[model samples]
Target: MQKALVSIAVAASLGLGATAAQAAILDDVKAKGYVQCGVTGGVAGFSAPDSSNVWTGIEVDYCRALAAAIFNDADAVRFTSLTSQERFTALSAGEVDVLSRTTTWTMSRDTQLGISFVGTMFYDGQGFMVREEDGIESALDLSGAAICIESGTTTELNAADYFATNGMEFNTVVFVDQDEVVKAYEDGRCDVYTTDSSALASERSKFADPDAHIILPEIISKEPLGPSVRSGDTQWFNIARWTYFALLEAEELGVSSANVDEQLGSDNPAIKRLLGVEGEFGAPLGLDNAWAYQIIKLVGNYAETYERNVGPDTPIGLERGLNALWSDGGIQYAPPIR
Candidate 1:
């Protein structure tokens, strides 16, 4: 009886030891020395390769921010281009650390797919783009129009739901990639193209005559596009979430890539906390104290990133309407660094 009891205690200790060995994702990423960021093949304002084959966009910035936080080097990231069909599978199987592509945070994806969307980096909506000659003022006028959209995306289902709910009819020309959809739309094979409003603007700008297209005024669905990770890693989720909020907070506090180094010595308490001066915020995530500072110094704040990539001065020319800070009547809010 004594021998049997001792064996049971030994087995329990082994089980506990095994459980402790499985650390959270943040620790795993730190140990690995770099982050695996999954992104789309190409989307002009969100994720795309330049002439030098360097990826740059809003989504790309998020990946860089994560790397900067973890390794204090924004370039310490390996970007893996993924299609919509492969994104969730890759994330679930741990092929990528985070999916920062323009993936919509939806109920089915969050609860059913075993992934957790950290937070919204870009608050978007589904909209349509039509040729100038089409005279379509709103999505309501798109009835009977042949629409071009990418398959295996939430946009497809949202398009169907919008048409069905409005009692309208239309034919869809589906493709596996945004480039194909854009080609089909530009070739006059489809009357209109439906996608995220940002993407619609991007596709419109690529046209031979940019002025020949107009994005309709109607936004049909809410698309909170953001970063995502596997569901089981709570620590990683918090790290991703706080990193995003830090960007927004930096913007609110007037920190920028151009001036981050100067602002690091400022007297503001909040700034110090965010810059790793007064707090040990990074230690819990297995990162250095100056993690957020590195991100701001290397990647810039959210506003700077937006302006450089997709803001009013760029070809994408997006205004900071809903993406502005909460103090400025936008929904983009961040928690205090304390």
Candidate 2:
């Protein structure tokens, strides 16, 4: 099943005029007329197709913000749904410009995958989900229980290490990808399902009875998820990295889509610099002076994106938690744009 996704991703890249592996990704993207983004096949609240088949989620918005920065059109981008196994290979092979899916930033992936993580978009942790009737109040109660997990992800290793460290024995019903894993869990093939706490919330929303499952409170691992790009393209990397920072900077500076126009006329130097009214911050990244401005005006700030996609008001219902700004007692912080 996942093998077919490889050909699809490669064909999409080739159709977009993939030329000269060493060629700068930005140049190639410009030539192609749109940014090619790789995303998970379907992960609600992260990157999943809506009823009309249009992709929607926080990660999708990140790509939209990037497109706004580069082309001044937030819709100037396309997506390819990828399985976890093919995401890295697809990126390394030039099959996609950026992997904006829910990929965790880990040591081995950072140094060994020939890819660079832009920044932590969402700080999450490993957790378990079970039927509310199971009466399992904690992950510690899952000893010897069969857990459904997706293969080719940090989830498996994290589940293994967590169980072993806790002196608990377990069995994993591994599947090739997330959709299959969810299906097996729903089919009653596994007694428990485990993954990032955010994902647990997202996936559970799709269940027949959303209130039938409960996510355990024991967070087992630190999962800093973010977008990533192929290594060796400094200019492209800078563009991708700064796009994330722009969202955070906008949130911190009180700039949003609704007020970006008004703030543009304000005299605050940081606001001016962020909106391209008083600084050339976009020049170094080969983007226009209004790059961040376009992002804020089109995609809104980080808080806006989070709230609209997966906040307490959305069906996924995730709190700001560690995704809140550093000034608000969270770890999210961006380097000043000077």
Task: Write one digit per residue (lDDT tens) for candidate 2, span 110-151.
Answer: 889999999998999999999888889988889999999998
RMSD per prediction, one decimal? 3.5, 7.9
Going through the candidates in the order shown, the clash numbers are: 0, 0
The alpha-carbon lDDT assigned to residue 204 of candidate 2 equals 93
| CA deviation > 4 Å runs, candidate 1 | 1-24
What lDDT score goes with residue 285 in model 1? 71
Kindly provide the TM-score of model 2 when superposed on the true structure, using C-alpha atoms: 0.93
For each candidate, give its TM-score against the true structure: 0.92, 0.93
> What is the per-residue lDDT of model 1 for residues 8-90, given as tens digits with 9 covering 90 to 100?
78966766433343356766787888899999998887889899999999999999999999888898888999988899999
